[model samples]
Target chain A: MKQKRHETPLEAIDRMTDNSVVFVGGFGRAGVPERLVEAVCRRKLRGLTIVSNNAGSNVAGIASLLQEGCVGKIICSFPLAREAVAFRDLYDRNLVDLEVVPQGTLAERIRAGGAGLGGVLTPTGVGTDIAEGKPLIEIDGRAFLIERALRADFALIKAYKVDPLGNLIYRKAARNFNPIMAMAADWVIVEAAEEVGIGALDPEHIITPGVYVDAYCAVTRIDQMMEATP
Target chain B: MTANCGLSLDQMAWRVAQELQDSWVVNIGIGMPLLVPPHVRADRDVIFHSENGIIGMGPEIEGGDHVDPDLLSAGKRPVRLMPGGSFVHHADSFALARGGRLDAAILGAFQVAQNGDLANWKLPGARTGSIGGAMDIAVGARRVLILMSHTTREGEPKLVDRLAYPPTARGVVTKVFTELGVFAITEDGFVLEEIAPGVCADQVRAGSGAQVKTDGATLMVPPDPVSPREPVLSRA
Candidate 1:
């Protein structure tokens, strides 16, 4: 028989070493794994290189970590959406390091990370200073973008439910960045609302399979929330 | 006014073509400017570019039946391709923008100036701002045309003497359009080009917030009218 694998969201995060690269899933606080985010927040991990689609707005979530000095660098697109408070400050003071990724390339990079590819070829920011000094490759007489693969020590996302076996199901826009990050991390953690025994849920509904998951924890709701009004 | 939009939209489209015809390549920034493709005179040839890498783009698909996953417009919506259409590397598409291959670009503006200074990227009080390829297009296009309303929601003029917010491109704009009329940036400053059928030059100037003068010649309006199609953008 195979050894059983299980852990709480906090325990999953506890497994992370300080200053490690982390891949988080969320499109501006939409599907962020609350339990894991809280644990990382409380853990106060420093010098962390974080990757995500958009940093959460001011209240809590990704931007919250920036407030606590927990994040050292970020790779993302449109970091300063309407509700983004911390990012503007960090940008103004030159405190946080940011690498601008064009919107489409940002999505493809995450997908590339999940596909087990070392890097993806793209031409998004080539020639006119977008990808200058970065690696460039031509395939079939056509230029393609060559962006490096990104992996995280810990990956986090919200789930509607997860099997004890670690398969995950997400709800709505909540699916935004969760499933992709799951594929690109060494350890995948889910902070789900319900936990069920394996085989109790439909495999079709599962966004991420247990094959990539390392730990999970059940939680009521993520403490962080952000919007234009918030 | 075209079918779904206002008279302003049609006037702006006409002005854009007047300034940009014979241009080898162009990319209309997303949003209102995205609608310009259908309005452009089919007889005048121009190679259109979309940020999503589709060239020689045509009117959008109504039902999205063929929905090519491999190709979509910058909006991520399914779009039909023209006969000679081709897909380039997405990176190459952007290279065309940054590399200065375009002759003229017509973009929607949040604000413009008497001298055609532009601010279309960010709002100061808003937490986030969009610089999406606008910076690249504005700087690279040899002639930049701004399609915009005369005033903001606050009743302040969009055509200010100077830009109110940080500008994505500096001094690249060539013209402006409003419900009031059309104005072109000239060596001296904003010179009046036309006043809408019922509006006066002074009224257009007052709303524009910049010194305005005219060649004092009657303006010619293109007769081939455009009908705005219902927006294909689904409610997000």
Candidate 2:
């Protein structure tokens, strides 16, 4: 079995290149890969596209990337949080590109990318601005908008526990977007709270099976600002 | 509109909460809709769905020592999970809404047109706004209930004949609960289903941008507004 575990998060995230499309998993700070995001910020790579639920808030997480002028485009569902001044400033100044997708469609599109599907036809965005300029198809007397699959060069994700083989589980609502992102990216780097022994995690309870994970690091700072504080 | 003329915000939330049926899986949207779940009757067994992957979610966790930062609502407020609660990832969680598993979705709105068209995501000519999960919940839920004030703070009616703002979905809203009363989106138009105690049909009509039919509408006399911990039953 391959040893997926790495000595540190910075080393685990060593393969990310400049101008890469990255998937940062989280929903309003839950399940966010803070340490990996910090590592990417530390690397100061430029012109990256970030796909996530929220465009990072003003202070932490993906905001650090935007603060460093590293992002070129952002594809997300909501970018208008009160503290998301970082994204708003750059977007208003035309310094970055923005594509707002319906939250469900974003998830389905990523899932389609990982599952080897062509695209998704969803009713979530029909009759709205989201439907504008997108291909519309009528099926069974209902309209559905065509959303293309979204793939990334790398995915930064957080997990609760991982085994030597990289099998993973998440705590509470922190599982948002992490598992699917793990499959959608070419390389999946995980920052987990604990690294357990193989076969220690119950097979029935594991959320992301080890085969999808490329590299993993066990984080010592367990409670280090995982949530975007209000 | 006068300050004392309409139901309080909590009263409006209680009115909306009363409409939920037993065993219904309901998705509560952010903002004012967040106020509805807390008022839900404990006996109703209404499973609350948060877009960020919590099912059977409980109330917001007040500041405490043991608050797990990972456990949060879609609104990002720390919350607790009920005994039968379970968690799924983002895709599977939204599948519950888009796949028609939700019995109802209670949401906050900017405008609800007479024909049940909903405009909530963004304002007209705004540079940026958040769509979030409002669109999915609007089109996929079996029923959509809206909670908002009868009029904006500027006193402009939110229940309109046509939407000036961008719509989240068309012909999706089943009912709307506001400070003035409960308005059911019927085939005819907005029908005044329940009027607040101090408000009259003329006032409701004046407060609505669309025509409001008050025929056979009943008066809603709620009991004293209390903390959400206790059920605020209405007079039968």
Interface RMSD of each: 11.9, 4.2
Error of 1 at A132 (Å): 2.0
DockQ of each model vs. true complex: 0.07, 0.59
Across B100-180, the per-residue lDDT of candidate 1 in tens digits comes to: 777777788888876666777667565446555566567657777777777776667777787777666556788776666
lDDT of 2 by residue, A63-107 (tens): 889999889999999998888989888888999999898899999
lDDT per residue as tens, model 2, B14-122:
8888989988999986788888876777677788899999888777767676567888888888887876788999999899998999999999888999999999999
Q: Any runs in candidate 2 off by more than 4 Å, and if so which?
A: A224-230, B1-3, B230-236
Cα-based TM-score, every candidate: 0.57, 0.96
Q: Could you give the fnat of all candidates in order?
A: 0.06, 0.78
Clashes of 1: 9
